[model samples]
Target: MNTMTKRLTAVALATTLAVSLAGCSHWSKRDRNTAIGAGVGAVGGHVLTNGSGVGTLGGAAVGGIIGHQVSK
Candidate 1:
């Protein structure tokens, strides 16, 4: 594959990973933390990756964490 195709593939793979993890379960602090970390990581990752669409999953992850921030 060419350089462009490889970059596209990397972006696509990252996008898929980001989206697929959305709406993940949060039954424990560990699970919650993992989700938050991944979500924030995705956003940072997306920014680092210079992707807009790919950041939706990251946003959701952060949103979920924010939503659950009050939970025990």
Candidate 2:
């Protein structure tokens, strides 16, 4: 059981890292807002929900808005 749990945890970590890195590489400055939003959302989500999903949504919204304003 312990071994299985460890394997699953490792897979989840790898997936998260891959996704973040892949996202950074694919988007350019033109889409900076989107990237920022996502990052903020992630942090917010954690903070807002005590590491729950709600914080993520809030962070995303705030980040996106900030990014947009910066671009303008």
Candidate 3:
């Protein structure tokens, strides 16, 4: 990827991480799991798809759903 794209992706990942952690003070275990799942899924998707945004998003969605259901 280009320098700009890498920078943007890093920024986005950092922002997502920050946002997810910042609001976790009151989150339930399931919420935390979902967040963790989404983060992992995003990274996995990015790796698997060579950083395709659609794959990353789709992975996050699927992971979040799985995480949410896992706690039930």
Candidate 4:
């Protein structure tokens, strides 16, 4: 990736992490699990798909659903 792309990707991941963690304060266990899953999924997707936005979002959605279901 070029320098600009790298910087943008870094900013996006940081923003995603911050938003996920920051919004989870006082959340229920299920919510926390979902957030954690999404975070992990995003990172995994980025790695597996070479930083694709679609892959990242898809992974987050799938992971969040799995996390929510597993918590029940």
Candidate 5:
């Protein structure tokens, strides 16, 4: 990837982090757990796939489901 792509990825990740942090204070424990799971899944996916879009999305979806189920 080029420098521009890397910069854009960084910006997107930063934006996601900022938004997630901003809304957490008002969320229930369940909601916070799900979000945390998704974030971890995204990072895990990125690492596992060398930052492939499919892997990231798959990880987020799977992580979200697992997190939601665990909250029950």
Candidate 6:
């Protein structure tokens, strides 16, 4: 995909994740943190890797793990 498309996709994904998480009133703080971390990581990965899919997924995974552990 072109650079613009990739950037837009990343932004959309992040926004969707954030908005969806915001509506989950029953989630604990850790749950929220994980979602937030995944979103941020995805964006960061996309930027760092120039929109590589593998990079994005890896970032999300690492971020989720960190977020999950942060509350401990």
Candidate with top lDDT is: 6
lDDT of 2 by residue, 1-72 (tens): 355654564456446745775757656664766665566555645554654456556766777677767766
lDDT of 4 by residue, 1-72 (tens): 665775677568758787868866899889888887777677667656777899888888887888788799
Deviation in Å, model 4, residue 23 alpha carbon: 6.0
Q: List the residue pairs that clash in candidate 5.
A: none
Report model 5's TM-score to 2 decimal places: 0.69
Ranking by lDDT: 6, 3, 4, 5, 2, 1
Error of 2 at 72 (Å): 0.6
**TM-scores of all candidate predictions against the true structure:** 0.37, 0.49, 0.69, 0.69, 0.69, 0.81
Per-residue CA lDDT of model 6 for 1-72, tens digit only, reads 688887798889878987898798798999988888888888888877888899999999988888888988
Instruction: List ranges where model 6 is wrong by over 4 Å.
Output: 1-3
Give the per-residue lDDT of model 1 (tens digit) for 16-49. Answer: 6567656555347656555656555555555554
Model 1 CA lDDT for position 4: 71
Model 3 spans with C-alpha error above 4 angstroms: 2-19
Query: What C-alpha lDDT, on a 0 to 100 scale, does residue 9 get in candidate 2?
Result: 47
| All-Cα superposition RMSD per candidate | 7.7, 6.1, 3.0, 3.1, 3.3, 1.6
Better of 1 and 2 by lDDT: 2
lDDT (0 to 1) per candidate: 0.59, 0.60, 0.78, 0.77, 0.74, 0.86
Give lDDT tens digits, candidate 3, residues 1-72.
Answer: 876776677568858887878878898989987887787677667756778999899888887888788888
Q: Report the error of model 1 at residue 71, Å.
A: 16
Separately for all candidates shown, the number of backbone clashes (residues 3 or more apart, or on different chains) is: 0, 5, 0, 0, 0, 0
lDDT (Cα, 0-100) at 24 in candidate 6:
86
Q: Candidate 1: where are CA atoms >4 Å away?
A: 1-26, 52-72
Query: Better model by TM-score, 1 or 4?
Result: 4
What is the lDDT, from 0 to 100, of the residue 15 in candidate 4?
Answer: 81
Cα lDDT of candidate 3 equals: 0.78
